[model samples]
Target: MADFSSEIRQGIQHISESVFMRLCEKVGTSQRVAMRRETVDIKEMVEQQLAPNDGTIQMLSGSDREGFRLKGSDVDHMYWPNDHRVIMDMSQSEYYNMANTTLILSDSSESPPGFTLLQLLTPTTDIDVLLTCFRINDRVFISSSIFRQLTYLASLPNSDIHGPCVSGDVAGLEYDDTLCFVCDYWPPSASSWIDRCQSWPDPEVVDDIVRNGCHFVAVGHPLGPHANEEWRLSFSQAEYKCVYAMNHSQFLTYGLLKLFLKEVINHNLGKNNTLLCSYHIKTIVLWTIQQNTLPHWCPQNILVGFWVCFKLLLKWVREGICPNFFIPQNNLFLTKVNGSAQNRLFLQLHELYKKGLACLLQSSSVRSYIIDVLCSPRLYICTDESIIKCEVDSDVELFSEILQNDKTLAQVFYSCMKYLYKVQQLIGSHLTQNQVVMLQRLTASILKNSSFILHNMYTYTGVNKQMYIADKISCHMLKSAAKFGCVSDMFYIAMYYYRTLRYREALSVIEMSKVKLAQPYLMYREHVDRDRYTEAVGGQSWSTKMRKAVVLDIILDNAICYINELIPEQQAALHNKQHMLVIPVFLMFHFLEFLCYRHIDTTLSQAALDELQVLVHYDQGLFVRDIFRDISWEILGICQQITGNLQAALYSYQQSLEQYPLNLIQTATHTRIQDVVSYSQNSN
Candidate 1:
């Protein structure tokens, strides 16, 4: 067990160092950097282009600005008129006067004391842009009339009537881009909400966040569906500050936990459709940090730290409620994860933990193998040049019979768990060596045949009851098999010993089985790339063969989905059409690897800016092109200031101010630059 602990520590270090480094190298590449830059550029261009006629365009919220942005993610922008009084002065009747008639009106409504919501389509982004009228004074608005009108607007016809906003495509938008709906408050201010947090957080951090100001994001959608036009006061800036305040190891722990959720829990056995999400994991991490002392986060105790995080998740699963970090009354998991699913997930995690780290502590080469398989390029970019030769015709009849009968993968996992439980219960109750050997082979047989049961369960309706009985029958057969001398049974016997804490016996059995048992194989196979896929099939029209292939793929996904739904923590959405075809679903699975690998590098490089100067130079685009273009130079300057390189920091700050000069950000950047310059002068 102590040896197992050492192996686990080595694995943790490999994850934190080697895997983290690989992620940084991948994320800090020209292609990823360019994608981020292009996203920001598109937002900026759209903002600038829309400014003159519409109003002042501001980038309200983005993961990029907050510093958790990954590649290919979109940016959020807001539109507010230069004159605050323009919309503020409009009466409910006069709301129609302000509308641009050329812009197609999806919905329009009025509120007392003068408020109007005009949902319109913009030319460039082709997403819905929401314009609302309201007065923002020193205090936040809590008007019932306006709230009523906001809620009433839900009845109006629009692409995103279900939620606060819509994405992908709905109606009237000819483009295929995912739409980010925007909402504007005339007297837009989050100061009132910011002031309410004075006694809650570290005062200095709150003060800094207040100085940065906050955005009142519209939350009138039916999802959370609170009061109409209910704007949630966001403290994202403050949240980012809190994240950055952590020591590097602490940050690495946070990143690893996120990776665990995405890769191990989600990608494993096609469980990506589970109710657990990155945001939920992030909130748990934040809560853990807030309650615990700094010593709990020591680098050597990272495994323990990870366990702590997992325990928090387990606690949430059992309780069936995860409180919102800032607002205690708000339940993050309220409608998301049902109680049955929670119990299933709770059991799943319990099994994993009980199995211990030997199962988890794979060699670095193995980790690389897993990462490479997960992050392969085939999952993302479609490089088929066959589009020129092929034609896509939308035949409603062709897709009409496309079956959505498959279940989530979580089902198979649940079945496996039941069998394992039975094995555990029967293993060490005064059993003889022969009995133990029989138990081992039985468990292995159950593991092997569980796949068939899962397939039958997924394909047919109402098969769960039959499968449950079948599972018990399989367990009974194992008891009978105990009389035989099966060499393959030793591996199972050892696993049971390991699980039950008979470590020496477990090791001895493993040693005895070494000559008899073949090496266990893991096939982390690659998804076919678009080029290869196109070449294999050749360019062809949408035919019955293609449709049948699509149906088969859908069936495979349905099996995974059925398995996942057994737990039901994930959002309930049909697997996207791409996922149901011969063509691989949007690019490759490398995203799972990169989730863990990519984040730690950003954290470490930012923390150790001095040592990173050369890498930063090589990946200059990481600084210049991405969402951090404005802040990149500013961060560089801060690093310089800390390292006593005052002249360098001064130059860096100058570049920061030159790129995107927001008053508060520039003021701070300028202050640092000036202080550095003054210190250099004094030294001279």
Candidate 2:
């Protein structure tokens, strides 16, 4: 690419790294260490009483256990009673009798967020037993032991020293808000109800994560009058694994996302509002990493990734649906924030996008760490995905056998194609890994062979003109491929329409592709032969579904809108075959469209200039003797000036003078850069 002016380079780096540094400060290492120590102590204390017999009733959770907590974050401990059968077999009274006989029962009427804890005073530390029972298996035979255990604990047994051995509550557990711990029991069956997550994640990663001992947590219903009995399986362990696997840049990106949600988005919406949480932000980051390639996540491109994730969050917020990462059925935002509040959060994020990072600039110790490197061009290059390109060329038979045996191959094929389509530009192609290239070739081969087969069938059947193949076969081969879940074909077919200038037809195909995208997730229940596919339908988590939706939306909003939003006259101009179009003119049109559609103009202008610079570098033929070159240069300077990069603006103006055609050069214009810089300095 074209060299960015020093000032613009410095500005981008300062803002990006400043935001990143602030996030590190917010989730400082010292705090993480303290939280870890406290969590270990709590786990040890809870285990001392509960773990000795069965080694079951013990496991601390929350950010402390997950390894991504901010300072002073609440550490959650789950006292998993391992006597699954005994806990479920006994009656409420009998269960109470058993628990009371084993440990000293406390009548401390304090109940924490989810459970009823039995307070215990030890020699060194005071701990509470969360009288919760859970299961590791999903079989219905596996009982809801935790619920029964809690029910037994909640029984009333009056005493002299403790005021009352048990409270008046039917289930010994009482919700007193003052209790340091409460047992939130998820029955074993309920706790392990859902474990079909094998369909969504990469097979390699899934194996690694499973090996790390990720089990479902028993989470109760969000909208329960008494959610004690109704437990939902949780993927918190899996989620923790996903986060912990991230490289340094990925971790930083995730931290930044959480900070944006808290310090910026949540800050804008009042504290009382149930704004987006760090969990939701973390979920978004996990999905982002899974969907994109390794090259796409290079350290230098962390800011781009952060921006992409923020946009995804905005889309979810605007839709008023933040689904639980592992379960699509559970909408995290259902009771969290209403439409008005969601709208406010959306607007706040939109403001950040428009105003650029300058809106979040702060004078703090965090910002000081990166001050020297803030101006380094290495971290602040124009790293947008718009400039990447993906291409495929392969024989039709290459992946035929794989597609036949591996149902998930089709889905992967579709994802690869969609990824390629989004990143491809006329210049500055993105680097693709071997895996992506292989998938692309395999998908292309399948599509080519299918089309060839269909053509041959038509030729043979149409010749007789009676009982034709189209009717008899209905293209059984393609239908079978579709049944096997070949989503990539739809994308390829859509591109054909898009390229032929059939805008409306292209839009319809694009819409259909989205339906096909969700087909596996939605119609999964109906597919009896689930084993045929490495990934079963309906197995996608909430984050997976949202990620797919966001991908489609980006394609539609950016690529499709380029066609749909064109005015009649502009549309007509595009159809002219004889006339040549300059690359800058076409790109500038898109930049203007983005400016018109968005709430802010500065970022759009910067992105547009970045694209133009890239184009000039890779495809100089497009700008040689072209009038748009001068326009691009002058506009770059103006955009830099608007964004408060005076030195960059001066450099851009100087470049503009150099690029001007012979007839356009003038002495008055030559001095413009110096004069503008002098004026800006005096004003400052």
TM-score for each prediction?
0.36, 0.36
Clashes of 1: 32
Residue 137 accuracy (lDDT) in model 2: 38
On the 0 to 100 scale, the lDDT of residue 270 in model 1 is 43
Local distance difference test values of all predictions, in order: 0.41, 0.41
Instruction: Report the C-alpha lDDT of model 2 over 1-684, residue by residue, as the tens digit.
Output: 025586665555555554444544454332332333333432233224323333334344556555454542444434443332112222322434343233222211232222222212211111113333222232121112353443334422321111111122211222110111222232223222235434345566566554433232222344553244333344555565565566656776776666556555656554355477777887777766765633455444556677678777777878887755554545667766666877777787677778654434432333444454555535543323222211100111112212211211111233333433432431144422322323333333344334333343455464655335433342343333333223444443443334334445544555565465445332121122233222442343322322231111111111111222222212232333101112233333333323332333446546655664565435544323344454355545554564567787777667756763322322323455666778887998
In model 2, the runs with Cα more than 4 Å from the true position are 1-50, 54-56, 85-205, 208-228, 268-272, 362-684
Q: Give the lDDT of residue 359 in candidate 1.
A: 25
Looking at candidate 2, the ten consecutive residues that score lowest on lDDT are 389-398
Model 1 lDDT tens row, 1-684: 144586555555444343333333332222232333333333343234424433444543434433333433334334333222122223422433334422322121222111223322222221123223333333223332343334434322332322222222222221111112222221223334344553335777766655554333344323432346444434444566666555545655666666566556665444235778766887887777776733445544545566677778888877888866655555677666767877777887777677554323332312563355245523332222222122211111122211111112123545456556755665556644323423343343444334434434544566777755754554344333322323333333443333334456555554554443222220011212334334433343333223112211111222233222111111111222122111111110111111222233444334345433443334444212332334445545655665567777777778767763211245566566667778888898
lDDT of 1 at 569: 12
Give the Å error, residue 614, model 1: 39
Q: How close is candidate 2 to the true structure, as a TM-score?
A: 0.36
State the displacement of the C-alpha of residue 236, model 1, in Å, after optimal TM-score superposition: 3.2
